[model samples]
Target: MIYSIFTALSWGKDLTHLFKRIEESKIALAIFSGKYAQSKWCLNELAKMKTLAEKNKLKVIPIFYKVKVDDVRHQKGEFGHNFWKLARTSSGEEIKQWKEALEFVSYKMGLTLCENRYST
Candidate 1:
């Protein structure tokens, strides 16, 4: 269902439209994988999801795939390494928003899939 909404957009499409769709969604499922923080778009979506959750009671379900919740929350381990690398080139406000979003989602109860579980 979520992918259905995204199917209309092509690769490298404008994110503004995606953000609008996110605002309209009743539920948002964020899959925080190893490279999640590396993508600014993902972080922006997470930030919007957090705002929606706070103001509109939008349900946010985070699925940690091959990543630890602690790593995401504290920005440690591989996720931290990459995030900090990104922070070096990003604006302060942008990093702040990403950090807040990661912290907010990490605290919520979510499912974590072990690295081996999804590997062939």
Candidate 2:
């Protein structure tokens, strides 16, 4: 089974269409992870999706991305560089938000690093 964790923007843009495809695919499950999914507009849409999925007995998991400091700097190059720019220009509140987003991405990247390091 192929699981998908599409972003919030992607969901907003084509959720109905994508969900339809997913239903047709008859996959085991579909997972989505994003912060925007928490917004009021998105939440309502999510509810509709949930209802539809439940009606068809489809499995859909939504994961919220949380951030951490220790892992944020792991990808210290292009991607990190862009984040750095945002970090520099962001207001205190925005920085706080970005930090959270970065943490999630960084932690996943860290896991990738660990796997590669231990691979023989």
Give the residue spans of candidate 2 off by over 4 A.
1-5, 8-71, 104-120
Name the lDDT of candidate 1. Answer: 0.80
How high a TM-score does candidate 2 get? 0.30
> Cα lDDT for residue 49, model 2?
42
The numbered model that scores best in lDDT is 1
RMSD of each: 3.2, 10.1
Question: Per-residue error at 87 for model 1, in Å?
Answer: 0.7
List, residue by residue over 1-120, the lDDT tens digit for candidate 2.
Answer: 222433332465755665554454332221222233223333333444444445765544433223222423342444345455555654676455444433433333222223124210
lDDT of candidate 2 at residue 21, scale 0 to 100:
43
Q: 60 in model 1: Cα distance from truth in Å?
A: 0.6
Question: 1 in model 2: Cα distance from truth in Å?
Answer: 12
For 1-111, candidate 1 gives per-residue lDDT tens digits of 352256256247787878777766777788888788888878877888888888965778788898889999999999998889888989999999989999998877778
Query: Highest TM-score among the candidates is held by which one?
Result: 1
Residue pairs in candidate 1 whose N, alpha carbon or C atoms collide under 3 angstroms: none
